[model samples]
Target: MGAGRRPSGRCLHTGGIVMKVSYREALKMALREALSNDPRVFLMGEDVGRYGGCYAVSKGLIDEFGEERIRDTPLSESGFVGAGIGAALGGMRPIVEVMTVNFSLLCLDQIVNTAATLRHMSGGQFSVPLVVRMTTGAGRQLAAQHSHSLENYYAHVPGIRVVAPATLEDARGMLATALENPDPVIMFEHNALYNMEGELDETAGAVDIDRAAIRRSGEQVSLITFGGNLQKTLAAAEQLSTEGISAEVVDLRTLRPLDDDTIMASVRKTHRAVIISEEWRSGSLAAEVGMRIAEQAFYDLDAPLARVCSAE
Candidate 1:
């Protein structure tokens, strides 16, 4: 069985049961499960309820949960998103869906200034148990306006957990974890991965929202990335392997409480690092990681850190 799948022997068979689901389907299931399990949980965004979401990830949910719980807000990103933060503060768990990360910029004030700062500013008196979901990345050639990976922007903020659900397991588990967090949480789903199907294990546990995960092990060079760049990094790793350079791939699943120890440990073992990101190189997350490597792992390095970031 693949890493994402449970063994066939472990499968439950009450009377010959068989079913399959895609990554997108798994995400819907997670959302539906959250709604069914908790009345406090509700979804709000443009086209989310009646239109079935931009990618159809929320399809059929409106009928099941009704319009109140599964709401379709107006096209105003800042207005509706800010409203979500307010709703969360009012003791409701709102899963605010931004059509895309690029559009999320219009509501940066709410996300960074409001949702992220509420808990700390209130001295823990208030908690923003909110989840903001947005599609990110630039593979479909949607041009600049529609295509941008803004996970780094969110990751740079404090008091908010930034997550990228790269696999089927993460797609299924991240929603519940995000809701459980007392602070705000942002989940970036790569636009390119919505239809990429993978098997989902029934017993998969909640992935740590604060730790980096090593997706592949190697000994020569380290390829560190998250979100949509992960697949590119892995492909680069494989190509480098053929050239006699084994590349270890590290997926920084959660960018806010960055698992720097895991990243540094990998760098210590490999002695070389290559940070990859879909964001532009200048002032990008890759640049931040490179700076950290130089600061902490300067003495342990075999060579200067390298980076492969998107072109402006």
Candidate 2:
């Protein structure tokens, strides 16, 4: 099997022949596909033009699409972010890269009050087809300022959709779906997963924006998580399996709509649950998952639900 490939009675194969793309390349391809398919689609962010983006995900895009469509903005997250929202209001599908989620705090007013509330406040008269992409998670010791998983903050809002693209497929397909949605969408890409290589099945269909995916299934316990903690949870699951505890891992890709049905189904089957999140333990998304499990699957539980969240 390849590094990321799962066996299906075929012999092992590697050397990147079957799976030849990096996570960053997958995202770039998705953006390229979106721009090619939609005439109104454009990207704007700091250093996105000649600088090739902070992580180089936008590298060469400006060359192909020209400076007009792949416009670069100043270092003002609040200004460009608000402008992106305004552009969306004016009938444009805008993909605004915030560089990092920590910096996105500067634009919280626009993201929360404007982009998130416009449609509801207008009684469905308006829509913001905006996609804001940002790097999230910690591990490189970029310190507190440069590193933090703020997906929960976005998920707490009601109107905006929060998504975390964990796998290559998600990294590839989410941009198009977010662009198509009539509401603002915030995509959190873990910094640690950018270079991780994986397969890209061109024939694979688009993943739903409101569903959870079972990456690995088991019966003894359920390990629920999304985003950066996904790989860690899978590692923990494998370790648990060594001791005879089979862990079912559910990737809650969409946090806001939160495929509760998928979570409930997994909990029902496994009867034991543990949620892992990189955000601080207090009032995090993990707590929300635990509460829902208590409310709906309390009687099905063989033990109290467990959680492993970060402490910052």
Candidate 3:
């Protein structure tokens, strides 16, 4: 949306003003802005350079920013992640792409032991301004290895910030805010959302990462969710409207610092809450949010808090 660049193809809705872009294109816009606005920012990951990213999100970045800025690392996840952390420590802002959520496990030690703890361990002397972007969520197109929604695993850690952008505006804006945070940030881009198309204003830029967004408002019930499930929940809400069920939708955009205030506000208003998550039921983010709502808004609920999660 800035003078630097715009999404690849253009689509005019009405009045020939607004721009329509896919989730992948919006992400490319975000990356372009981050590279243009700051000198220290750079991207490094597998297939990110010559191959144009596993999902083709970085398709044209290498030509525009060059190989040095749009770098491609080796197959070793831990090694490259550790190098990213070191780059952050040395005053460079690094955005590392891990290809998928499952592959991120290969570098868990570097992420948890080093990147997540370095600031606390160094007594605030070190700050890892690193952003790790990876594909998450379940889909049949990509095999089992690339189909796991493991964002909850990263959200479980104490030091890093976890965010999933489910909308075009968020996909275009969240990266800048994540890059600005002094601590580490992990961005989970659902594989299924890559082709999603939506409209974004010309002036759209960075967005908030500290609060959850209330996507829809109602009174009968609240449909709480994030990531790809937000679209499913909103669609379900539309179907529920035909049945005379007024459902509110809350998007937990930021997973790590769960916005309890927003979640409780919705729960108290609806008096009934159902958290929908793509992760497995046991120890999922839905479980944690359900507990928070039950603990804080117990009296307001007409029935016990509920969760609809992946049975697998």
Q: Which lDDT tens digits does candidate 3 get at residues 1-312?
A: 222366545556565556778898889888998998999999999999888899988887888889899999999999899999999999999999998899999999999999999989989988999999988988757887888888789899999999999999899999999999999999999988999988877668999999999999999999999999999999999999999999999999999999999999998998999999999999999999998987899999998788998887
In terms of lDDT, the best-performing candidate is 3
What ordering of candidates by lDDT runs from best to worst?
Answer: 3, 2, 1
Better of 1 and 2 by lDDT: 2
Point out where model 2 deviates above 4 Å: 1-19
Q: Give the TM-score of candidate 2.
A: 0.93
Candidate 3 lands at a TM-score of 0.96
lDDT (10s digit) by residue, model 2, range 1-312: 121223123223553224457788778878888887888899999999888888888888887889888999988999999999999999999999998889999999999999999999999999999999999988576788878888889999989999999988899888888888999999999999988786666444356788999999999999999987888889988998999989999999999989989999999999999999988888899999999999999999999898898776
Against the true structure, candidate 2 has what lDDT? 0.88
Candidate with better lDDT, 1 vs 3: 3
Q: Taking the candidates one at a time, how many backbone clashes does each contain?
A: 0, 1, 0
The alpha-carbon deviation from the true structure for residue 93 of candidate 3, after best TM-score superposition, in angstroms, is 0.6
| Model 1 lDDT tens row, 103-216 | 999999998899999888888899989999999988576787878887778889998989998877788888888899988999999988887665566655466687888999
Worst 10 residues of 3 by lDDT: 1-10
Per-model C-alpha RMSD: 4.3, 4.7, 2.2
- Each candidate's TM vs. the true structure? 0.92, 0.93, 0.96
